[model samples]
Target chain A: MAAAEAAGLIAVGAGLAVGLTGLGAGIAEGNVGAAAVGAITEDASLFGKAMIFMVLPETIVIFGLVISILAIFVM
Target chain B: MFKRSVRKGNYAYTVTRVKAKKSHLLREEDYDKMIQMSVPEISRYISEAGYQKEMADLAGKYEGMELLEHATYQNMANVFNSILGASQGELATMVSAYLEKWDIWNLKVILRGKSYGLTGNGIKEDLVPAGKIDEAALDKLISLESIDDILNEYSRMGKVKFPADVISDYKESGNLGVIEDYLDKLHYQRLLDSISPYTQPTKIFLDYIRRDIDVVNLRTIMKLKSEGIYGEKVMKYYIPGGMQIDSKFAQLLANAETVSAAAGDMSRLDVFEEYIKPVLDFDNYDNKAVVSAIKKYQEDQAKKMAHMYPLSVLPVIDFMVHKETEVRNIRVVARGVNSGLGRETIKGLLVI
Candidate 1:
């Protein structure tokens, strides 16, 4: 492949990786976040625990972001 | 019809709100404290607790059993309505559908009161305002002269089904039992229609409804058997859609001579085997005793379903059940205290 074409392909792959993972994370967080809010509404003590659960799925997107950065810089 | 609308509901927030509300429900210790207090003290305690709004609303108008019962039901309606408001999308629909039972209950209260020559205002006090029907409509229904008038009003309102001829026949026959049975059947049938078991959450919800139907059927069989009446006559009362006891199994259970035998017939089902078996050995099958045992079992199963499906409609349903139980318990305590019944006896009557 031409050098420019290869770089374009890598950019496309990085965007896809981050975009898909971000979508997945949004879906996961939507459910957990709603539940967390509900829990916290009932018992304020649950706020800390709910926060942890609500953010747990966010790691997926973070990892994707890392992959995108590596593709742009390290590649 | 409901299958197409099976979008993800706002579960987590709703469930959390329900849990918070659930935790505030009067505990066993609260009941214990309540049992020992005078009727006034009990009322005061309730007013101080989660029932302040209901108590405040009805303040100075009533007292004792009447006041407590009215407050209890009002609190139930308020809590349920608020939950319905908080829930959005499909959960809101399901919760609203489930709340129709309150409408059915309120209608029955009206019918029963009217049959006894109660005035519209008398019946109005007992109505629970939790369902889709507005207070004005309920008032209009209560004031109507006959069951036919109420039926016409409901029909005019739309989407509510009432078999005019059959109900008229029931009224002519002076058989409120048959009419009530017909209404209950229709309510359950409508509930069944509104729920489609295509999705996992709805499947679980369907199962919960079926299990409730099963318990109701089992109670009917046990009650009939205890009364020494049996055979095909009992089949008329058997409700459809029970997961454990279909019409066939209900028939066999109806045929069983004793409560133990009827329970034995049901022992194959995990639910029956767990809750019913332990309570089957009571020496005399006081209908109340048998009913209480089944009620306890049903409550346990409701709690289990809620825990298992924390994000489904189960938690809200469970909260409703617990709220109903709490209302009943409060009534029992009020009556027990008034009648000078002992604490333990009153405690024995409570399901919590």
Candidate 2:
């Protein structure tokens, strides 16, 4: 009904989207990070590869961040 | 005495460490070098390799082949003990149970020594302190004067009490096979009681154990059938809990006229035997060849399991199996070389 209220509601939606997705990403990265560290410990040469695998799940959070940005600015 | 708690988180760390260790196990190239070298040189090579730290303690007391065997067995036991120490909760429980084979192994050696009237000092060297049964307990079991006393100690340890009749049967018949078979069945029962096949993580482990049981039962049938003993005699050695080959298949294998026929029947039961066909000569049915072939198949199965379930306990179990095989192969090489056997003959005995 009002422009200010609409903007506030949009901000809330963006925050929820990013926050929940970030939490999910953290949960996913926990196991991968543990396994990657284990691999690196065995062979330091795996550091690069393990880092790549460990960070792969962070893409979800990045996607959420992009969606939040669009919702906040464009919507 | 045994406890089970959910420790699924520990598998990642344990499996990773296991993979690292597995990568360091003696490869084909190492065996190539080992087979070419003399016994003393083989000892030097093993010492310079993964057995270095363990060899440090035993190097002074033993030399040549004796030193190598002692160092290899000690390292195997210590590595397994370290693995048990590294694990946690349910993983620890399952690993502990899986490792009870070493306890059973040590106990059987002791019992066999006693039956042969060998002294405690003689038996001590053969005991591997790799399982939950500590060194002191093993020493105590070794020191006991009678079989009844040993069984009492086992009972105190919460193990099943072998019947008086069986002990008398062993005494009268002077056959230690009965006791060893009883111990194996007890170990299987304890394993079944501790972990449920319905649970996650453990299901994979149970599957591995079942496959192992299948291989062991196959080996037993082959050995007995080759020896010309059939019917109930073969059944005496069958350890339950095998999934791939049921009691019926085992019975059929028991009744099979020859080892080759049994191996043929076994190959039809599962893919495990499919790999054994080429190595197994249908007409000859050499028991030693069949034993090695089955061992090879089990190792391959373990490797497949590690690849299939990298994040589970399969990797650790695979590592344990590989390590044991490495130790055994080194022993074979050492013995073969010391006795002036040719390199090709020694290589034939190797699992790698």
Candidate 3:
């Protein structure tokens, strides 16, 4: 019973690490995406530059995913 | 009671779009090149540059200075209207309110046109319908026979109500100055009332408005002082709510003996020390120079605020100011070139 309860808590922690970081990344990317689209609409040459900015925040979510994988499998 | 929802505006999108448009405004080199060109060549240059549609549409109807004037005004209206269209929620409210000055300008034109017995089309050509008042409403107002009729129609539109006594005062005095002053004051009053200075962006916006009021007040004082008119009469044209020029400060400036004395007194204030005072010094107080210096200072302040708060309404406002300056500079160059003014004279007139 003790071991089962500890496993359940660990699962919740892993879930939260991924879920909260994903939400944060979504918010950060939303603003950048809006600004990027605006710039691209004005000048087509900016598409490459805007695309880079649009994906910059996505690395945060990757970090969170790594932590969650380690928590679930490596633990 | 129901809770009021907080309004959110698309700041990121609007600011980026505005900055993009701002980048396309004419640079100093463009003006230098324009100053050397003749009127027709200048017109062609601007046509090639962002004003292609307006120039093409108005080309057959007008020529030379007239063409430049109409095209620039049309482009201004289109650009301002586009900005208003792009903005939403709180941003929309603020931008629309700011552009109401054009409404006042249109009203002044219509009233002056009616009083001068100008034909409807003649008056229509001068009006820039970029305000809350649509082109159709302006057309309807222009078709009205008398000034009183126009005022009544405007008030009936449920936007802003003109004081009943304004018409009576105008009839009694036969001067449009009274009505114009009232309209100017009304514009500022409405602007102040519309803004709530609660958040950081809003607080900065309010500060900008106050500074604008101060600039207007200082201009009036300087103009009147240059004309040797002062004392109690000066207070009549005074606009309240300036950041620095309060009623007491204005009274003090009014009591100063000469224009240089007034400039000296103003120099004590931080804002005046840098750009305005040196121009208004005893040796060089030409009205045109003073006006241009003040404009340069105003543009710098706007640019500073826009840089400081990139995601706020300041960027939009900054773009509007720059767009107006571009139109004005182009007009000055066109008129000067056509009139055979010296290049130095025309360049001096430009704010670039």
Candidate 4:
């Protein structure tokens, strides 16, 4: 029972951190997205190019998600 | 679109827009070609590309240098205010404040022009349209009856103190630096106060400011030292706010701090070393010193700021700096062709 309880606690903590990490990533990505779209609005031909930079920040959140899944599911 | 200060999600949208515009900036090859074009050819090249609408609008109203100057400021204002419009909350807030650097430039133009009896129309052509204050506010500025009128109007829109008494005194003396210092000091104080909450970001931001201050202070020192103005008087007009050039540092510098000590403290303060050290060296370029200093200011600030966190602000800020440099280089090339200047003069003005 104690072992099960400790695992549950660990899962909840990682889950919480993942949630906060998403929030920070959202803030980070928000700025890039705004600038990306802003550039597109000036010239639509930039759509493809802007998309690349806009997606660059997604890896941060992906890293967080990977760590969280490793901690919860790998065990 | 931004009605509030940037908070969380605002950065992504703005950075998105900035990236698209970044691709359109003049490449080095384009600049090379621009150097060889005649004035009309330069105008035609711009019209064929992105500057068409502005070139058309300005083509009739002015020509040569005047036309180029007006179109540049208009596009610049549009881009700057566009960033503000696209941002909201804290993101818009910081961008708006920094753009105020242009207002300090504009106001200096006005006060100096007014002192020289240059017409309002002549003075108006050079003004950049950003700086957080509204167009209506800037319009009110151009039509003002007195410097006090400008001050009172600015006070309503923001927290800048208008040195009304100083304006009156300086009007009689016809000393332009008095008015320049007021605008400079007000802008610097506001910038410093705004960035207090974010320690690392503020430090990084102020380091740019310090490097900028060092350049201005050094130029003033050089000019004064040559003109026989005492260091004390030179120090007075030298606005002291930068970490390295603040009051005590200025005094120490005035007292002849070793070039290494001054350079060491400044490099410690920020990556300003790249900008400061070149000029501090014994064999630094004496000709076109201001152009080099200002160009390094723009380029280094761009590199340092590109890595800032919360990526929204940095991308926009980076694009604006790059765009401004682009316009400036084009203008330099255009003017060089008109004046029969060699490519070296035009190239000297280019930041990239």
Candidate 5:
């Protein structure tokens, strides 16, 4: 019973690790994406550059995912 | 008590779009080339650039310098209207309020036109229609028969109201100077009152406007002082709420015996040293040169603020100022070319 409770707490921690970072990435990307789309509407040639900026925040979520995987499997 | 939340506008999108539009404005090289071109050639050049629609639309009615002038004005109106449309919430409110001067300008044009016995078409040519009063409403106002009728119609439709005794005052004095001064004051007063300074961006924006007021007051002081007007008489022309030119400073500047003396007093202030001092220090000061220097300083300050706060109204305001300068520059070039002025002379007239 004690082990089960500890495992459940670890699960919650892992969930939060991914969830909070994903939320942060989403907020960051929302701003970049809006600006990117605005620029793209004005000049279609900027699409590739805008896309690169739009993808920059995704790395944060990837980092969170790595941490979550380690917390669940390697721990 | 319920607290109202501070409403935010879509700064990211608006700023980005404005940046893109700003990039498309005429560059220094373009101005250099335009200086050598004839009026028709310049018109064609602009038409090929970004003003294709305006050029095409106005081509039927106007030609030569008039064509360029009308096209640039129409394009400016369209650009301002688009910015107003793209902005939301607080940004929209600020932009619309800033553009409200155009409304006052249009009304003054109509009043002046009516008094001068100008026809509707003649009056319409001068109107910009960039404010809350759109082109159609301006057309309707122009169609009105008399000055009183136009004023009545405008008061009903416009956001601002004419004084209750304005018509009577006009009749009594037969001078629109009183009414025109009242409108100018009303524009600045309304602008100051509408802004709340709720956020950092707003605080900076308010500071910019106060600086603008200071510039205007300084210009007025220089003009009045040159005319040998002083003290309380100068105070009548002063519009308050400047960043530096307070009542005390205004009085000090006003009481100066000459224009250079007034400028010397102004130079003691750090802010005025760069733009104001060099231009006004000499006797027989060219008003146009002083105005241009002030405009350049304002533009530089705006560019700095816009850089510091990218996702704010500063970028938009900067773009608007630059766009107006572009239109003005093009008009100068066109007019200079039409008047058979030399390239160097025309270049001197350009602000760029």
Candidate 6:
């Protein structure tokens, strides 16, 4: 019972961290994505490079999600 | 630090997206290449680059400087107006107030041009698309009989308010300086008072702006002093809003011939928060101090920007400023190339 309770609390903490950072990652990526799209719209050659940076911020959320999932199953 | 999760996803996303867009701006290589090219060649170069569609589209209606100006304004409008529409909450509130600054600038342009009796075409070229006013409204405003008419139209539409009545007295007094000061004070007051942020990002942004204002005031006082203009009459144009440019600062600025002298004489600040802290003895160097100080400010801004990855309000503002500087530099380059001017003169106009 003690172990279960501890795991539950840990899961909740991970969930909160994921939620916060996930939103942040989204917002952070959003700025770049819009800017990239804007620049690309002006210049098509810019499209390839812009697309890369736009997706770069998503790694944060992906990391957060992986951490949360790992915490749930392993930790 | 701005609270990433505290804000709406939509707002955060927009800021991030805009930040990415600022990265693709023309670098020094492009400008160097452009400098060696003719006007037509430059236009073609930009066409082959990012401005292809815009150049092709605007090619028919305009050519040369007109085309370039239109392209620049349209692109600026499309980018910034999108930012204005996309963001929500406090960030939106702050950016919106700052954007409305264009409205103030537009109004001034309208007023000054009208006062000078500029031709319609003359006034139109100077009007950048920085305000909420649409093209049609701007056309109508330009054709209006008086500044009062434009203000009245805005008031009637409930789109905005103008303190025309307050400005009227100053206008009648035959001192444009008073009217200009009144307009600036009211604009800054409304701008600063309306935007409240829960995040430190907001504070930093406002401090940056207020610091910019203080520098402008300090520079203005310096310029006036060098010209031997003094007394309460000339000082009436100066406002009291910016922190460092208070009474003591103003008095010292108005009195000192050089920056080092001013720094030595005034209550010395251990740190100048917003602007580049002037180097020791900068006060004594006559007119040259202003240029050095401005360069220092730019370098300081670059340092701050280097720490943060590209995105947020900073990038957007940075792009606009850089674009303006670029445009000014290009104009200098264009004129120099066409007229066979010295490289030093052209270099003076170019900012990094």
- The candidate that achieves the highest TM-score relative to the unseen native structure: 3
By how many angstroms RMSD does model 3 differ from the true structure?
A: 2.5
Q: C-alpha displacement of B73 in model 6, angstroms?
A: 3.8
Q: What residue runs in model 1 are displaced by over 4 Å at the alpha carbon?
A: A36-62, B1-6, B156-158, B256-274, B277-283
Pairs clashing within candidate 3: none
Q: RMSDs, each prediction?
A: 3.3, 3.9, 2.5, 6.0, 2.7, 6.0
Query: TM-score for every candidate vs. truth?
Result: 0.88, 0.85, 0.93, 0.76, 0.92, 0.72
* lDDT (0 to 1) per candidate: 0.82, 0.81, 0.86, 0.69, 0.84, 0.62
Model 6 C-alpha lDDT per residue in residues B50-78, reported as the tens digit of each score = 56666677778898866865665665666
Interface RMSD of each: 1.3, 1.2, 0.5, 3.5, 0.5, 4.9
**Residue B271 CA displacement from its true place in model 2, Å:** 6.3
**A1-75: candidate 3 lDDT, tens digit per residue:** 998998898899888888998998988887798799889878989999999999999988888889988988988
The 10-residue segment of model 1 chain A with minimum total lDDT is A34-43
Residues A1-75 of candidate 4 have per-residue lDDT tens digits of 999998998798778768877887786666667666666677788889888987887787788888888888776
Model 3, span B104-145: residue lDDT tens: 999999999999999999999999988878899999999999
- Residue B259 CA error for candidate 1 (Å)? 4.3
Pick by DockQ: 1 or 2, better one? 1
Q: How would you order the candidates by TM-score, starting with the best?
A: 3, 5, 1, 2, 4, 6
Q: Which one wins on DockQ?
A: 5
| Cα lDDT for residue B325, candidate 3 | 92
Tell me the TM-score for chain B of model 5: 0.92
For the predicted complex of model 4, DockQ is 0.44
State the TM-score for model 3: 0.93
lDDT of model 3 at position A32: 92
Candidate 2 structure quality by residue, lDDT tens digits, B238-304: 9898987788888998998787666557767564445567677766766766677777877877887
lDDT of 2 at B56: 82
Error of 1 at B53 (Å): 1.2
